[model samples]
Target: MKMIKTSMLTSVIFSFLWVSGGTALAEEPNLEAESAILVDAETGKIIYDDEIDVILPPASMTKIMTEYLVNEAVKSGKIAWDDEVKISDTVRELSLETNLSNVPLRQDETYTVKELYEAMAIYSANGATIALAEHVAGSEGEFVKLMNEKAKEIGMENYKFVNSTGLNNKSMDGQHPKGTKADEENMMSARATATLAYHLLKEYPETLETTSIRAKTFKEGTEDYIDMQNWNWMLPGSVFAYEGVDGLKTGYTDMAGNAFTGTAERDGMRFISVVMRTDSREARFKETAKLLDYGFDTFTYEKVIEKGESVKGKKALPVSKGKEDAVTVAAGHTLSVLVEKDQKEKMTPVVTLNKKYFNEDGELIAPLKKGQAVGLITIENDKDDEYLQEEMRENVKVPLVIQEDVEKAGWFSLSLRSIGGFFGEMWSGAASFVKELF
Candidate 1:
């Protein structure tokens, strides 16, 4: 897979001018969010982006990492969902803080890891998040170290995590661990947040089972029962409920404004959108819906080449000192790329022969085997003669492989071919010089 920036409105504007001979460009969606991004869930392709790399506060969206680590622990057998965790005094006090979002827990009470995870995921409960972090790493400070490590491993650029709950030290009422300042808060760009969401869903898709719960009761049927609701409004029954929308998280704070990471599927195409620092809570979901709609309406995955199919107009490669004089090459796999509906006609595959397959004299070597990679096939958009103008846009790349084995010729045959090749080269050079003189 090749990583390339999605064709943004700016690029599209230029493309329109070049394609239509100076015609007016089409209008694009006007999003109200401060930062936004859309990505293909399966390929991590950025379909749209606006100020996506500008770092900003992430608020409770940070809990996604908290939930992710907990799931990792369970999968690794380090902990079980059914295991009981004793509520520490620090966690109980943090839960009681009036400024923080939390579900109250008794200091003497014990709750299952699964129960706490649900509270943290659905409600963005800071207390529950801290409790889980401590349970996983033995201390909030240690857990925070793990959070940064995981973020780095996931390829997150320009992000920082001061706490698992996403709260600045000011919101913690001076409860922050030593060496941490009061104003520090978790921060990440919208693009990095989307990247994190992609890996989180890819590795543990079952997390959707928890994030999709619209409403559920913790400690059901007991006097201690507390009802929790998912904060993400993109889910079903919400004001901006979108079809096929499911599991993800939402976040907000005075510094972070309103933020959300939403995922949806339709006709086998799944997408992830991240909107951060919107003016209002509703704007986050609204912008996300627009992004997803743009993606589904504008682009689609089209297969441009089939595996084992020979490249059109390409000749077989000459094989020196081989029983077979030449060998055919074909695509090793089906090549598919996401392209705009109208631009599909411009998509073309260009085959580039690998220099390593040839000898110093530019002749293909013998003993070539079937399925051995011999070249690269790059998918390019050539409408408006972009490729000829040196403005080529590459979407994806696949390998071209030899289609059959070419055994080396015997010693006697090799000697004869060498002599013939030398004479053939000399004659070709003399003919080229004579044509130039004429």
Candidate 2:
């Protein structure tokens, strides 16, 4: 089956490899889920979309925010991997609930931050999730604030977080954290979830290091050890394994059904996909695969511009009071966007100069250093392709820089040029006057 999938992707991408004129390869996928979206991980391009903004329960996928915060805390030096997190009454009680996904935690013992994180990441352990949340925020309630704050920061719309764990509050054994009510669960739109995952991967790429572990032994060498299995079936060696698939979260609940935020890389391209409320685990994975297939099959990753390449009519920036009238400029770096085979031509550069380097007349001041950042050039789609996140539009822009130095003109040189300019203007007026007289 894996071979078949690989074969199919190659055939589809190959047929359209040379396609031109911005022809889209196929219709958007008919995903069997309440909402879905597919995005280019690096370019933030919305390759496909469905009812992506409908808010719904995300089940264990809420742990994504938890994972992101833990990694962020470690990075910020606020926490340590070896930091010990003691089991709280709430965590211990939740761990004892056999009905939920978890590896039991002993009240008399404590675990390292890394151990609990792996359990939550790989096993969807509700208890471990709450433990890590408390460790980070002093309480799960405070963690929820951080979660929503981060949501707004990332531009997530139609999202809510009543608790750190995605479990329905009523099922928190009546121990739901403060500031929330019974029966409330974490909720997010498909777009919101994708946006969250996108930022998580981009900001904390080391997150993949943990999420990629298919199976691990929690508390490995002790009497409390439990072997935890990853819930993401699309992970390598799993039943629904897809090549290049790694490091993401999955979800399931009576209300949520089956949901997944999946990412995979092949060649130089990586794609992120979200499928919400599918009928079953199998359906979710299969739908996610279909979403990924569309990204890989339909879109081509082409370098639209090369570093230091000149754009038409943008070869240089005008200078004021300089030995040379202008300084040479070019793209500070190459810019690439995920484009349909034919859509490559439709992406155009929008260059906006940085005003700090310029005067009121919009000319660069003389004495500018070579390779100074002067502005940014963004690649915009002429076809009005809607990006999943507004920020994606901004991600494709490359910094613009000066290619050479333009020394300030000396006082004598300035005077000479001013006189030359005055004479040049007089000659232009004389020519016009002569033409009128004739």
Alpha-carbon RMSD, each predicted model = 7.7, 5.4
List per-prediction Cα lDDT, in the order shown. 0.82, 0.87
Mind giving the per-residue lDDT tens digits that candidate 1 earns over 1-438? 122345476687788888986644234568988888888776676767788889999988888888889999999999899988878788999987767778888866778899999999888888888889888988888888888999988778889988988887687778774456788988999887887888789899999999988888877877767788788888899778888788698999999999999999888788988899888988888888898888888778887889988778664778887899888888889887766765655678888888988988766899989899988887654332221012113336678898989999999898888999999999999999999999
lDDT value for model 1: 0.82
Among residues 3 or more apart in sequence or in different chains, the pairs in candidate 2 whose N, CA or C atoms overlap within 3 Å are 22-342, 22-343, 170-183
Task: Give the Cα error of residue 173 in candidate 2, in Å.
Answer: 1.8
User: Cα miss at 189, model 2 (Å)?
Assistant: 0.4
Pairs of colliding residues, candidate 1: none
Candidate 1: 10-residue stretch with minimal lDDT: 383-392
Going through the candidates in the order shown, the clash numbers are 0, 3
